[model samples]
Structure formats: C-alpha cells, structure tokens
Target: MPEVPQPVNDNTIKVRQLSHYQFSWVAGEPGQNGTYTLQLVLDQGAWEEVLTLTADDADALQDLLVNTSVVHYDVERRTLLFGVTPAGE
Candidate 1:
C-alpha cells in the first residue's frame, strides 16, 4: 500500500520546489525620480519583479538576508550581484 501525502494544514498547499533563483537591481532611467527595482529570476525561466526598494530599504534588506546563499548589491552604482552558498554551510 502506498501512503498518500498529507497537507500540513488547511491553508498550506505543497507545490513544486524552486530549483534555482537569481536577483538583480535595475536602476531607473535618468528622469525616473531615483527609484530602484528589484527583479527575480526563477529556474532560469520565469521572471518576476518582486519589489521596488528605496536606497534605505536595500540597505536594510542586505543586513536581514546576510545568511542566505547569495547576496550582492552596490549602493552607489545600484548594481545587483548574485552567488550561491554551498550546501551544508
């Protein structure tokens, strides 16, 4: 007999795992009023503009997600960097 998978809770639904991810900060054009856009790429295919971060927001986010696999950003140039921390860190 095969055991069926169970949901953790009524509101919890299991879905496909994200195999890979990428993040980047795009600088707004000259007249865009100094706004920055954070973009995310999933599984090397799908694309999503997750959020827009202000200068202060980006700084705070960098500190919060320091333990994650990859983190890269330049405050001056507004360039986004990406890297993956090895497994079992």
Candidate 2:
C-alpha cells in the first residue's frame, strides 16, 4: 500500500528579523507549471523557510516590493506590513 499523506496545519511563525533571502526559478516539463521559490533566513539567521509561489503570485509580490516604501515583519503581530512606515518616525 502507498503511504498516506499527512494533513497540513495552519501555523504561523513570528519573524523578528530577516538576514538573507534568495530567489530561484525552476522550469517545468512540457505542459507543466513552473514554480518560483523564495528562500528566507529569519531571526538573524536563526532559521529559514522556503515559500513556493506561482508565477503570477511572484510577480505580484515583486511589484509590491518594488513600489512599497517600507516593509516591516512585525513579530508581535506575526504579519507583514507593507508600505507602512516603521515606528519612531
């Protein structure tokens, strides 16, 4: 029998700081979808996470990053704040 797949959970990680990032693109076979991988090193290199996004999604994120003036990874909120000024203005 084939091995069963495990269920995925909706968990969130608080990011205090990001130390590094890398982007990669893999071409899919004929008639297949390619994927973009965004590798992130968080918490001053304490850990890392890789996110796979579709081409459209990756383009959208790139646009946002290009146009945004500020980006914040709020640890307490556990979310990304784009185009919002950081504290202590």
Candidate 3:
C-alpha cells in the first residue's frame, strides 16, 4: 500500500473586541506590527491606519477606557475613541 499525505490547515485568527466607542462604533487590538487600523465598507472597501500606539500608550489607553455606546472625547477625560466598526455590526 502507498502512504497517504495529510492535508494542511491554516490557523484561524480570532478577533476579540478590545474597546467600544459606541454601540455602533468600536475598536480592536493592534496587529503584530503595532499599528492600529480600520476597515471601511463600500463597493470597494479600504483599510486605514488611524493610530499607532507604543507599549506605554497601549497600557494607558487600556486602563483608562471601557466598552460603551457613546463616542466622545472630552478634554476633562483626556481620552479619545476613534470609530472603527460600522453601525450595528
């Protein structure tokens, strides 16, 4: 009998929600390259890099923010929520 080769499989990338700017807006963790980006929807949607955070910045932001449905940035709070996910997604 001839030996058979096993099929190869690709790794699945799981997307976890990191932060929510609003019910209709949210953001995810930066990829391996340390760059945060957003993808828009349209006939030909595109991905845009909105911000780049250092290790310190990421730690600060993570500690200061939480998931919410109100997308606002106040001088008093000194926190900014950039819209990434589309409405009702």
> lDDT by residue for model 1 over 1-89, one digit each (tens)?
97756755422322222234334566568867566544544234332225577878766656645545654443334444445456899
TM-score per candidate, chains pooled: 0.36, 0.58, 0.27
Model 3 RMSD in Å is 17.0
Error of 1 at 79 (Å): 22
TM-score (C-alpha) between model 2 and the true structure: 0.58
lDDT of model number 1:
0.48
| Rank order (by TM-score, best first) | 2, 1, 3
Model 2: how far residue 28 lies from native, Å: 1.5
Each prediction's whole-model lDDT (CA): 0.48, 0.65, 0.37
Residue 18, candidate 3: Cα error in Å is 12
The lowest-lDDT stretch of 10 consecutive residues in candidate 3 is: 40-49
lDDT tens digits, residue span 1-89, model 3: 97645452221211223323211223545654444322212112221113456556655555555444433332233335444567799
lDDT of 2: 0.65
